[model samples]
Target chain A: MTSRRIESFVGHGALILGALIALYPFVSIVRHALGPAAGSNAAGPFTLENFTRAWVGGGFSHSLVSSAIVAVGVVVVTGAIASLAGYAMAMLDVPWRGAIMGVLLIGLVLPAEARIVPLYDMFEGWGLLNTYWAIILPQIASSFSLSTMWMTTYYSALPKELTESAAVDGANSWKAFTRIVFPLGSSALATLSCLIFLYTWNEFLLALVLLPQNPAVQTAPLSLSFFAGAERNTQPEVIAAAAVLVALPVVIAYAFLQRRFIQGLTEGAVKG
Target chain B: MSLGHRDVAAPEKRRVAGRALRSRPATRRAHRLRTTAWLYLLPGFAFYGAFSLWPLIETFQYSFYKWDGITAAKWVGLKNYIKIFTSEDALSTFAHAFTFILFYAAIPVVVGLVIVGVMTRVRIRLLGLLRTVLFIPQILAMVVVAVAWRWIYAESGPINAALEAIGLDSWTRAWLGDFKTALPAVGLIGTWVMYGLCMVLFIGGSQKIPRDLYEAAKLDGAGPFQEFMAVTLPGLRGEISVALILTVTAALRNFDIVWNTTSGGPGNATLIPSYLIFEGAFVTRQVGYAAAASVVLTTLILLLTGGIQALLRQRK
Candidate 1:
């Protein structure tokens, strides 16, 4: 009993230490962001000046708005399309289903880096560079495969009787989907939306390349890097403040919807 | 709810007319189902093809041509592929990605196993809170993570301050800025980002294992470590494969962290293939070369993940 008790103590000790280490960087960021401007030691007087400076200097107000539009656009578009595709794959009898499934699997595995060069060219050809569509369109494309896969898995796991009963009552596929399947899919939709939002908000490289000279279209994360670069010689607090500002919304969303976020990400992995 | 019921019932009114018109109602129903499925698939596939599939095909096509973003393209088959293989810098960048697997995949899995092992043996309180805390890094923007870690590794940053406090003042240096330590330092940041994911996966996997197996191992006189080796390890094969595939891909395609932290600097110590692709396409305007590098990188990722999947399947 004593040995077991001692083991539990050690395990708790290790877990606590690991947790603190995991959280320390965020703590440090908050400290530096809120603390005085001069030193790395976060013990000096606290001030809102760093945040205000970062807000104005980073041009984050505009970038944050851009990020919101992109994130929301990706989520809405990806979620709607993915859910439809998922419903088809899960509930309907489509010919060439295996080939479609294979395509989606390939799409899921293809890294964004692989297609980025040609995407830039393609978007440029379409005259979409520096436009919200450039970012939103690609993000939706990349996220669509996983989102569809997720919803397919979700729909497959759901009881078939729900849709079947509706179908038996002479309801068409579309009516059954809207009246029956869609209501039951609220959680899945929420999960997909959260995942898409997170991906779109955190995307940096695409925004950087596509919106190169346009601060108005630059995502918050991309803008934060430029902000930090411009102020490399300045106080660390300012940079920390900007970092916090860029990360704030997603962090807040995660805190509130952590269950959905975790479930969506891990479930995607399991399904894949 | 009433509206849903009415909608559901409304379709029944059309059933008599359809039944009276079609002698082969079953075939017609099947056709309708197929049509509906196709309709549902069209919008998703349209966006996917226009953006992802077409771009991927275009990347492969671009690899055979010599074209800047602006100038007219000249077809140069196999030249870009040959260059990617022959170029010393390109080779180093690929090598660096393999090195990152150590930090991104191996270390995190090991640490995750240890943590999960401990948690299974000794139940931890507030497990959800612990998970949330550890996972914060995974959720944060890579740029923000890089910025935070940059400050943490700065000359006057917290790490040096701690070292000075501990009388290891001589050990203090600009970690990311140092060539010798830059790659490993940046890779360790990946370790930090990924370990939570590994832990979460393993913990979830471990919970699915039947408890009786552990009890049976104990009854057979196995100690904790022995039980873990005999029971837990084999049980986690699927999760381990998933974790490996995810982390290895992250390691190989690691651009954002390297870009934000070191910018593949300190004498090319941390340049990964993705960064090279970006630099080639955007900075140096070597579009074909970048496309080749991308193709190679994608192949490498597929091979690694496919290899892991094959290994796990054989074990199963």
Candidate 2:
């Protein structure tokens, strides 16, 4: 018993150390954002000046709203498309199921880095560059495969008898889907929405390339990058404050919905 | 005799009526079902084709030409591909990406295994909190991570302060700015972001293993290390493959972290393929060259992931 107690003690000690290492950067960022500049004494004299400075200088007020717009657009677009396709594949008698599945699987593996250059030219040709459409359109496309696959799996797992019974009540295919299949998949939709929100929120490269000269349209992360580089020398506190602001919403959302997020993320991993 | 004749004739008429009524609705329902399915797929396919599939084909076609974003194009053929292979900077960048596989893939898997092995035996509390804390990195924007780490590695940053306090002040410098340590410093950040994922995957995998196997190992006088080798490692093969594919891809296609931190700077010490491709297309006006590099990078990613999947399948 004594030996077992010692072993548990050592294990907890190691775990606590690991947790500290994981959280140290966040702690440092919080401290720097609240305290004086680095060269000052380690103790008191904290201020909220950094948050105000970052809000104005970093242009996060505009960019955060922009990020929100892009994220919401991507989630709504992806959710609607994925659910429809998933229903067709899972619940309906769709021809060429193998071919459609093949295409989506290929899309799943194709990286965004591979296609960003051509996408830029295409958007330029269509007069869509520097617009929210440029970001939202590609984000919806890239995110489609995963969301579709996730919804397909989810709808497939549900009892088919529910939809089948709905069909016998004089409902057309569309009505059956809208009334029965859609409402039953609400939890799955929530999970997919959370995942899409996270991806679109944290996206950087597309936002950087598409909105290069326009801070008005730039997403929060991209704006933060430019803001940090431009103000690194003079405003360490402001940089930390801006970092917190950029990360805060996502962090809060994750805190509330982490169980769903984890389950959704690991769903593909387990199934594959 | 009259009643029997009437019964037979009426039954035949009823059967004919039923067949006529059923056939029309059945065929119509089949046709409607097909149309509905196609309608459901139409919007997804349209967007995917326009944005993803079409541009993917365009990327390949663009690699064969020497067109700038403007003006008429010249046919470059294999010249860009040759440059990607022959250029010193390009060659070193590819090598640097492969080196990252160590920190991003191998180290994370090993660390995850060790942590899981301990947790299996000791049953630590606050597992949920530990997982959430560790996964914080994976959720944050890479740009935020890069900025935060840059501060942490600054000259008067916390790292140096700690070193001075411990009386090892000579060892501290701007970690990301140094030519020697920049790539590894960047790679360590990848390590931190990735190990949590690996650990999460392994924990899930380990839980699926039967408890009896561990009991049998203990009944045979197997120690903790022996039991882990006999039961835990084999149980985790699937998770390890997944962790490898995800982390290796992240390491190779790592642009955001590298871009925000060093921009492949300090004299190209931390240069990787994605950054190179971006610079080639935008900075140098070498559209064909950049497209070719992208093609190669994509092929490399597919090959590595495919190989990992195949390797794991063979062992099974």
Among all candidates shown, the one with the greatest DockQ: 1
Measured on C-alpha atoms, candidate 1 has an lDDT of: 0.86
DockQ of each: 0.53, 0.50
Q: When only chain A is evaluated, what TM-score does every model earn?
A: 0.95, 0.93
What tens-digit string does per-residue lDDT give for candidate 2 at B16-73? Answer: 6655766676667666777778899999988899888987788788888886767887
Fraction of the true interface contacts (Cα pairs closer than 8 Å across chains) found in each model:
0.71, 0.58
- Candidate 1 TM-score on chain B: 0.89
TM of chain B, each: 0.89, 0.87
Q: Ten consecutive residues with minimal summed lDDT in candidate 2 chain A?
A: A263-272
Separate clash counts for every candidate: 0, 0
- Estimate every model's Cα lDDT from 0 to 1: 0.86, 0.84
Query: For model 1, what is the alpha-carbon lDDT of residue B1?
Result: 11
How do the residues A1-272 of candidate 2 rate in per-residue lDDT, one tens digit apiece? 67667777876776677677778887788778987765655455887778887899789999999999999999999999999999888877688888889888767777787788899998898998999989999999998888888889998888756765666666777887788889999999998898889989999888888888888889999999999888878888889999999999999999999987776666654433
Predicted candidate 1 versus true structure: per-residue lDDT over B1-316, tens digit per residue: 1112223344576555555655586656657667878999999999999889998998999889887878898999999999989989889999999999999999999988997786677666877987788778878999999999999899988889999999998899999999888999999999999988888888888888899998899999998899889999899999999899889999998888998989898989998899988988998998988998889999888888889988886353
Residue pairs clashing, model 1: none
The alpha-carbon deviation from the true structure for residue B180 of candidate 2, after best TM-score superposition, in angstroms, is 0.9
